[model samples]
Target: MLRALYTFLIVAVLSGIAIWLADNPGELVMHWRGYEIRTSFVVGVGAMALAAFLVLLAYRIVVSFIETPASVSAYLEKRRQQKGFLALSRGMVAVAAGDAQDAKRYAAQAHKLLDAPPLTLLLAAQAAQLEGDEAGATKHFEKMLAAPETEFLGLRGLFIQARRAGDRDAALAYARRAFGLRPQTPWAAQAVFEIEAAEEDWDGALKTLDRVVSAKLIPRDDARRRRAVLLTARAMTAAEAARGQTGEARKPALDEASKLALDAVSLEPRFVPAVALAAALCAETGRIRKGMKLIEDAWSAVPHPDLADVWLDMIEDESGYARAERAKALAARNPENVESHILVARGAIGARDWQAAREALAPHAGPSASELPTQRVCELMAEIEEGEYGDRGAARGWLTRALHAPQDPHWTGNGYRSARWSPINPVTGEFDALEWTAPSGVLAQEEVPAVAGKAEESVAPAEKEEAPEAAVDTVRALEEAGNASEVLAFQPPLPDDPGPDDEGEDDKGEDRREGERKW
Candidate 1:
């Protein structure tokens, strides 16, 4: 409405001007060379307006004629783009559906029709992979690496291929490159970390782990736990390398290892392996008090047998009774835990304190106890029986019962089990994957024949019937636990000590006798 009103006002103003021009009757005329043209002022103005409209119409016609070819080309280009995109979409769908033939066909069509190399290369790679053409897939992925837009994807593909081909160095290179390109990418960071770990590149793994933490791909606690494991592993490797060095020369490495282990312990105090390592390293560096305090603090939080071993190692040259007293002190920090009781019992047995051993083990091993004893508890009972009374027959009976006893808790995680704690899981190549836990299933109890109304006393060592398939399996489980400890770094047992001295036996005899038992 406003546009119409403006048009009406303009027309009224033009009519008024035309009426005034008519009243004034002024001429708008010009005399050219050999020509003279004259008209009324109003008529000349109207003719000039008509001439301006004609000029505009002619310019538009000429411009439209000039642009016609370009317009046609643009229309064709848009149609081609639509077809190419349709092919790309179909190729992606075919790849997802696992249809190699259709994916290949669509990929070819898209590649021929479109100038986009990024999307086409990925589809071609996937199609080639589906067809088991690894070289073709690799070629496509390598081509993708030239384009910055697809470089990370290319690295990922190449990394996977290298891993599948069992080329760790190549895979690690690709993963690191990908990580450098995009540190925030979870797969790239994790791949770099795992490859570094599997290759035992502890420093590289730690650096990659820091990147992972910074990216927040994993939780803060998990990142700290993993970092602790990496540090511990590095410390263990450094210690091993320094083992052949003289004491004076080894001081620097030992110091570094000690720092790393203590850092690990600080990250995860309840982690038994780290605590044990820190304690051992501290003792190695002559900081025996610090080592003892670390063990005590960790034991109070979570008692472990390894801590006991470390404690024993720290108190070198001490008699069995002195060691037992130290173990008692350690156990005092966490008396409510069964592990604390076991620690005390192990020390008592080593000291030949029969009463103390029996009293410490009574709650878990005796017939009056509420539940069945574990394999370790039964083995300890056997140790006590033989060490105290030299009763081979009763010891053999206890060993027989141990075959069917409940399995003890061990460091189990990531589909691996060990009798000792480790910083990483050998199966999954993951840090802090192992935990102190029992096996999921328990063995069924088998009945033993009674002799003189005592079933444990009836089993004979020489009887072939005592060693069945189940006993073999139990032995195998025991062997697995003992061997798994050796699979990872920082898992060797603490320094050895002389066994408890029996009456009428020398130290050599005690050592020989202790070595005879099956661990």
Candidate 2:
């Protein structure tokens, strides 16, 4: 409305001036270049205005003509940029799709068309990776490192490549650089931590883990667990170093190890390995009561056989009955857990109390139980039968049942299973990954009978055909036993017992095996 009003006012003023010029018409004359000109005042005014308009139009035309080439160049540059970006986008898509050929083609086209080497370099590296061209990818990643815009990206790429190629030193270097550049980046921090851990650089890994915790890259609980694992590992390393020392020389090292282990337990009280380690260190440092308390606390949170073993070791008594009494006390801490019952049974068997062992195990392993007993439970029953009745036949019968019993829980993590605990997973280089859990495929041949029949089916056909008459007689005898259910009531541990393999081992040997637990 304002613009239209302004336009109307200008037109009205011009009309008023024209009217005034017409009304006050007078002769006007001008001479220029020896030429004379004469017109009415209104006509001269109109002629001057027309001449000014022509001059402005001619100037505009000349300016446009002068700028034509530069304008066209800018337009072409913009079009090229758009096309380059399009190729870059397509290349990224092809990379995601795993179309190596298309990715490579688009990457090359984008590099040729785009002036942005930083942007195109990433596409080129990804394309090369898709094509399985490690050298090509490495070259592009190297080029990226020279550009400030792509430095972190280049570091990440190089770190991955180094790991894939099994170059730990190179990977560590790249990961450290990346971590320094961006401590908040989860992948960078994680890479650095994993590499440091894999290299057995526990101190370095612990520092890296602190950075991870500060950045809040992982959940707080997870960070605590990982930190605990690192501390435990450092404790183990210190313990190992102290083993060669004697008397006063060993005291300082053991003290440090004990402090570290205690710190780990403080972070994760329920962590079985940490608890056990802390307890063992306490015992070594002549703080047996403190170690026992740690085990009891951890057992209540999560009943683990390791805690039981460590608790037994802390006992001053060597008699079976005393051990059984202490074991019963530990079981009372986590009475509802199946491991608690197992612990009691194990103790009773050690005390030669077969009836106590049977009663402890019968709830879980008896015929009326909700589920079949685990291999460890069945084995315990065998021990009870052999120790109590001098009945080898009944013992063997229980052992036979054990062969088909469900597998007991062990230290399993990251596809690694062991009868002992470790702070790190050797397979994945992950911290505190091990947990006392049933191994995968815990139940074997579920469709088969839960007895010798299942074992017979598992044997080779020729072995089954050539089965000795004595073995056959044993199976028949077990079948004819007064009550098969009664035979299944008590379970015992096998030779390869999963209950904390560190028990009875020397401290030096246990420390050596800390990072070398068999998968």
Tens digits of lDDT, candidate 1, 1-519:
999999999999999987887689988787999788998887888899999999999999999999999999999999998999999999999999999999999999999889998888989999999989999999999998998998988999999899889888999999999989988888888888888887788898888887788788999988888888888888788877777688688988888889988998899888787889889989988999999999999888888888888898796788999989998999999997888889899889878988898888888886567789877787788778767757544465566666566667778776677776656677776766777887776433233222212522344644533333333344445545665564431121211111112234467866775665333
lDDT of 1 at 69: 100
Q: Model 2 clash tally? A: 7
**How much lDDT does each candidate structure score?**
0.79, 0.78
- Candidate 2 versus truth, CA RMSD in Å, comes to 11.0
Candidate 2 per-residue lDDT, tens place, 1-519, comes to: 999999999999999988887788998799999999999887788899999999999999999999999999999999999999999999999999999999999999999999988879989999999999999999999998897788999998998899999899999999899889899998889888887887789999888888898898999988887888888888888988987799888988998999999999899888777788889888988998999899888888888877877877775657999989999999998888888899999889889987788888877877567889877787788777667754454456666666557767766776676666666777777766677777556422433344545565566754543343335244445433412322122222222211111123467754564443221
Question: What TM-score does candidate 2 get on C-alpha atoms?
Answer: 0.79
In order of appearance, the predictions have TM-scores of: 0.76, 0.79
Clashes of 1: 0
Model 1 weakest lDDT span, ten residues long? 492-501
